[model samples]
Target: DNYNAINVDRTEQIPMDYTGVMGVPITFLHKYNPRQFEIVDGLNRYTVLDVAGLNDNAVKNHLHMTEIGGKSTYFRVLIKNRKVKK
Candidate 1:
């Protein structure tokens, strides 16, 4: 459960068994607002494992939002174990 050594900024973000992702969103603040899941964030409202299965396409530079105090605020986060420069 302690993924802090990795990309902890990815709220509610758990690891998965896949070929790994190439890129992920870049959020502003390191903190997030879980209360504003729907309006604030554009995420699938499901676990990381759930979304990747639905859309296999590249989602680089995408926009996401999370809610707080009944308000939806846009935020972007990092996707770990990504493609490193060769």
Candidate 2:
């Protein structure tokens, strides 16, 4: 998931079919439900990424640091759905 596209403000729009790791805006925590989702450390940190099994190349391609107009962007919280609706 692209951090630029998904955020807490647009949580309702998130796709339900996706089951892989996703990076979302930190604001998502405000509406977070522990029974439905699991928070994982973002790929921004080396140790966390390593523990999560995300390689450097994967991080570079998907979760690399982002900048808009020369300004760094806010952090994204990595998450995955723990229980999906059938």
C-alpha root-mean-square deviation, each candidate: 13.5, 5.3
Model 1, residue 19: distance off in Å is 25
TM-score, per-candidate, Cα-based: 0.20, 0.56
For candidate 2, the 10 contiguous residues with the lowest summed lDDT are 1-10
Question: 80 in model 1: Cα distance from truth in Å?
Answer: 9.3
Candidate 1 stretches with Cα past 4 Å from truth are: 1-65, 78-86
Model 1 TM? 0.20
**Would you list the clashing residue pairs of candidate 2?**
none
Question: RMSD in Å for candidate 1, one decimal?
Answer: 13.5
lDDT tens string, model 1, 1-86? 11111223344453443233212234433433344221122233222443434223323323222322334333333243332223
Candidate 1 lDDT score at position 80: 36
Candidate 2 has an lDDT of 0.57
